[model samples]
Target: MYGLLEVHNPENATSDIVFVHGLHGDREKTWTKNSVFWPQKLLPLDITDARIFSYGYDANIAHFWARPADNRLDTYSNDLFSQLNNRRAETPAANRPLIFVAHSLGGLVVANAMVDSASNSYQSLSSCIRGIAFIGTPHKGSAKAKWAQVGRQIIAYFGKSTNPELAKDLEEKSEKLAKIGDVFPKLLKRRNEEAKGRIELVCFFEGQPMNIGMIVDESSATLSGYESILLNGNHSEICKFGSRDEENYTKVVGHLMKWTREFENSGTTEEAKKVTNDAYFYGTNNGLQQHTNSGTMTLNFGMRN
Candidate 1:
């Protein structure tokens, strides 16, 4: 997932766009599957003079999210971002603006890398970053994590460390549940203050009946300069990076087109609006459609607690 990004450079390419996938996903599977179609669909329309690239990391949904406070998984954001910067330096591409296209946990990774100085690479990379598009990312913590905590406790009582299988499973569950309540909103607050006018933040969320709203209202929300949009798709299918499905693919392309237009026309800052809703704001996209049946489905890709 690291190294030179493969892209199509039309003559006179204006800028570059970086596509970052969520947890448990990588360059090939994440946005490349369906979302990759954006550039081709919008190029003639003049949305951007951009090319697409993906970032990779070592992520395990079962363990990483369960242990949010663990420094190992948390450090991935900075480590991967550093690789991206090195790649860009090694190969000079079109001088077009740089935009970050992230999904689910990927958004959090990007947000953390941008705001936190704990990672030395963050400060330098933040300056070059222009825009950020987050799909189904929980800028704030998700209720799903809270539910996972219950499951973790159950496993702890019955399946404690005496048995390796039980112990490992229990740990995985605990780590993911803990992550749901951690990071996100806190990261957003830090990101907003650090990046300020340098980065343009846009959120595209799932608005279907089962789909939850991005940030699900400002209370859970923390990021600033966020222009959010709602779509009629489940957490699994929201951004079909490289999908052949015309309809699903188009939804993402359309949003990108609109986002590019906004970036091209307006300056860095966009008006921030107040969102309203309770904890169960958008509800959960339950049933088999969620891709994971352990419990509740995740809004961003397959990362679930």
Candidate 2:
């Protein structure tokens, strides 16, 4: 089966929201707390006019030894495209305005998916995206990644086999990670220019440290121009909301509510008609434009784990 799972699909919905989980995260469990999945139980209650889907892929870093040498971000992006296309074929509403909520390495996968969409085969899927919410995504390299590599070495020394290849991929200064950081800005610039500010970006960073230390710091989690919100949780906890009463849950829902209102007000069908297929590949040489200073907001719920 395709790794895409439909969480809440309302009949009168106007847009589509897709959630992508991070490394070692399951499609359902990643966004759940106290036996309740937020995307299904809470998000639908707030943003009623959009269908929700959670995209899953094999994100096990420990299984890197079993994967091909060429298996990397591009491979994951291709798989994402295939699953999305398969869904589109089965349901025509999949073509509606799209928004992405990605966590950790899932952000990289989404970025690569957008890049892949510039090619002929995936243009439609790329063009459908209107907004993205990045939760604790390491846009730059993270110190925790380096520590993961060291931890793997320690495991290997103790006669426990581990995937060095995957460890290297997560390392702070790894060439693979650096290349993604370099190219992603250019891709965003091109996409933003083509969309004429129609595409929106919001980043959410963790305020607390993970068990292994901070997996993604504020500097690594945020992009330069977008609005970055600091939530009161660690890397994993940032995505998990126990109930609608939590401030973290409110912030996420508020963002989506705003996006959906703007989407419907702006006229979705008309906007889609305006975008040409060549819009994806047309603006490679344009310099990145300065985004209006939307500024950053730090939401301190004062709840810590």
Candidate 3:
């Protein structure tokens, strides 16, 4: 199976955005829906001449739930690369920048795709990936996988969910998810380190003041030489483009616009580093741009320039 895709063509555009979604998410649900889709919000920005593309993959949740976890890597990674190659081929060869806006599991796919592109292992592709905005990516492994393992054990004990796909997947992967849980800490740490310094890695984390303490500080989330911004909301609401939260949706749009323009003007690493702890309210552009109540990071586009 392949992922869904949406290409908003603008002839002779200088930049193109490729959108990727996370687990249990498809092209439309993650990028197109009016409720919280990113493309909708980004389209309204003052970007006069740009193209937007949504990259979907064969990340069928049912298959993921049924197949072994590692099996997912084998299945999805190639398609991820293939989708990017196809998109590049469709481009008009203007040597423009490509920006990836990925959510959740989509971030993982984007990373793998970049790794593949770097190796030149994928066919008919170019290393035009400029910047990335990872919204609530588990650059660290997910806590939910632990819960899923517990649920699987309970189901196994009762011999429940005996459907063939479920049964096969459980039999194949029951042991692996547990081991994955055990090694997740180190794995996540390594992933965080490996991810930094590769292009621009912008991570967006949740900070709704949950009783569970899910949000980590900016140091853990921020990458070297890249900027980070925290918003005020949970994981799900962080991606809401036009959300009433103001901090994430409204304010983020402004920051993103500023970052894009700046990146285009002077390229990366052109700004002075000034860590300011300013407070601003929602509804105002300055309030949204400089506010830090949530956990989201963005790496401005144009690394190849």
Candidate 4:
């Protein structure tokens, strides 16, 4: 079975949160730093009422030999849906309100899983998803994907073989990625309109660049009708929180609190409707940058220096 590590599962919790790591990321190492796993050590401490889980799959960057078939995003999505569905059947509280936290390509997997769940026998799983937090997800594709493809091709030319299909899917204008981008929003809107509960979304984009340059630019990360926050870190660093005192950690917790509150009140009160409506129309005011050191948050739509 694909790795499904439970970080924390307190008895009598009302909600569940799952984390999906990006490419080349392990369920444990993806969110760990200096031997401290934030999902276990920090997140559960803040969001004490929910059970936390981290999902893992085969996402290695390089392969010495080419496989018989191409492993597409849909394959990953199917695996995720199957695992979650099995859990829901096994655990009594597993079907409770669910929140997803995904990074990079994992975000695409989550999106596809939601779409698949909505149309299949697993619609219940779609309904249980209350919120999704995306970290540097390439909704519109990214330049780094092309760079990765080039690197893989170079390696293959030298001697070692690699899976070109996976790399090709990451291209900015690839048909696979474009199809997902087209269908995901429509599916989400339909789900929101049909269900008594609403699925809220929030995106966090990395402001700093790494050795491979900006993996996902601001344009590729932001989604319509969701709050997009720019944090002071690179692609990988954006998901790694060393301490609770860090700005990135605090912002993530704040969004989770808002989602949890809205989820709890969903379909029960008129105030919840207002909250959902307000969140739908929440404007960025030309965008904003939050400074954690000076404790200053300002609206600046222009490029970040």
Candidate 5:
């Protein structure tokens, strides 16, 4: 199932939060450490009033004789957009405030998704997004990307490497990836200019280094104007937490809580509340019918008299 899954849904939820994993990362495994799934086990304890979800995709940069050649970063972003938009559309959560927490290349996908949502067709998707927090995501490029290119070449020498354009896109200074890095910030800037629901963005960088040196340096993992937090682990460990009190979890969850509360008090998502209706019939209005809607309405209907 390469789509979104609702991992946590509580009564009277105030927002919907999605988790997108990075290259070669599983939706659940990316945020789990020592067999503890933080989003399910730890996060809900702190973020009690928000629904949680995780999106999965085939993120391997280079596959040894893998499936189709159509799988690319652009394709993944579009998949995420389609899945998220359709899942929320016409549902009680359609206009609810949304937050995206992504790691590594998942951040790029989130960035591109954010930019794509600006179009008129995806206005609902754009307006619902309230905050984004990226962990060890390569906003520019990372050393691991260069390694992916090298790995591709090494596998191609054996005639087993499938052509993966996403590898090239992730390479350090690749024009395509750079374009995403460039346009993403400007899109957020435009949102600020509109003075509408300005999306809150935060970049988290890994403080330690992997055996291949730091995978993503601070300059590559962060934007200029937004807030950036430094986590106390390596690229692989920055998102993993064995307990709620871990420094990484504390810093990250603290920001998520703060943002959720801010969105609640701001009333920015008032338009997207749950779709419900009530009617009263009196006198000769026996055949009266009532219809009310919230968010992007679809064909589905439910009624109670």
Candidate 6:
């Protein structure tokens, strides 16, 4: 589901910012309006040197006639990380510093992925992610869950099928969301303990109400003691912007700019281990050239006879 959202010149990019869509959303349509994809068109002007990507996945709460679906959120979590890791493995942007901007359930995926990334097996991928910025994500149980439950029941009733695992997770006071709210903070704490700068978090919630009222209220959309912001739009449009001048777009871009600057300055999470190596000269008159990740160093020692 990791699709490259922008056709950027990878040579100039030093970092990556990936966007993931939520339930019943498309990778392209979620962030696009009137065929203008803001991440590709508007975002580059501010974050010129960062590679952009958007992830996709099947997010059906209840399949018609109980169709087979991957209903586990943890499975989605694993897939997101695994697919992203594979995509970047051989690319020029392989080890560039990474971050995320996710919406709705996509935000949950990002959090769970990051939580999984903390383990030893994923150190390489985890070390590169500096932060995540969320838009209208539910960090707590939401009012929309009841409707989701009803919808699932209706689908099951027609098909004579039972509700799937995903339906239960979408209910208010979802067992999964509870665990994420509890464990996500602990994951960030562990990252900080590793001496790699602590992962940064920025959350956003919709200020305006839909016909159904605030599907995810402020308390549900944001976490306590973290940076939370307001977007003057409904839940569906909170993550979409048609132009660079929109207030929501401006605010989102402003946060992204700040993140890029911070990541540019934070340097690598892993400190370079100092090692001593003997220099060897192949010829009487030769230059010793040492190569490094940032650049090259050369020392010339010669005699003109």
lDDT of each: 0.51, 0.72, 0.51, 0.70, 0.73, 0.68
Where in model 3 is the C-alpha error above 4 Å? 1-4, 32-38, 41-44, 60-70, 123-126, 141-198, 209-226, 243-245, 266-305
Candidate 3 structure quality by residue, lDDT tens digits, 1-305: 24635556666355667777766566766554356555645564456455777766765434434445455643565676676666655533323455677775566566655544445666223244556787765432334444354334333433433343454344444343333333533433444464322234566766663343443333434444555667667544566655434556655555456545654564322111111123332233222323444643333333331
Better of 1 and 4 by lDDT: 4
lDDT of 1 by residue, 220-297 (tens): 222445667765565445656444346645665665666556544543332111110111122234312232214444
| RMSD (CA, Å), each prediction | 17.9, 14.2, 14.3, 16.0, 6.6, 7.7
Task: Report the lDDT of model 5 for residue 186.
Answer: 80
Winner on TM-score (4 vs 5): 5
Residue-level lDDT of model 4, residues 149-213, one tens digit each, is 53343334333344555544344324455556678888878867855656788999989986656
- Global Cα lDDT for candidate 2: 0.72
How does model 4 score by TM-score?
0.74
Lowest summed lDDT across 10 adjacent residues in model 5 is found at 276-285
lDDT of model 3, residue 128: 47
- Misplaced by over 4 Å in model 4 are 61-69, 141-173, 265-305
Give a tens-digit lDDT track for model 6, residues 96-195.
Answer: 6788899876887778777766663566777677778889887653334433543443334334343445455454424455556678777777776776
Steric clashes per prediction: 19, 0, 13, 0, 0, 0
Each model's TM-score?
Answer: 0.58, 0.77, 0.59, 0.74, 0.78, 0.75
Report the lDDT of model 1 for residue 10: 51
Q: Could you tell me the TM-score of candidate 1?
A: 0.58
Which pairs of residues have clashing backbones in candidate 2?
Answer: none
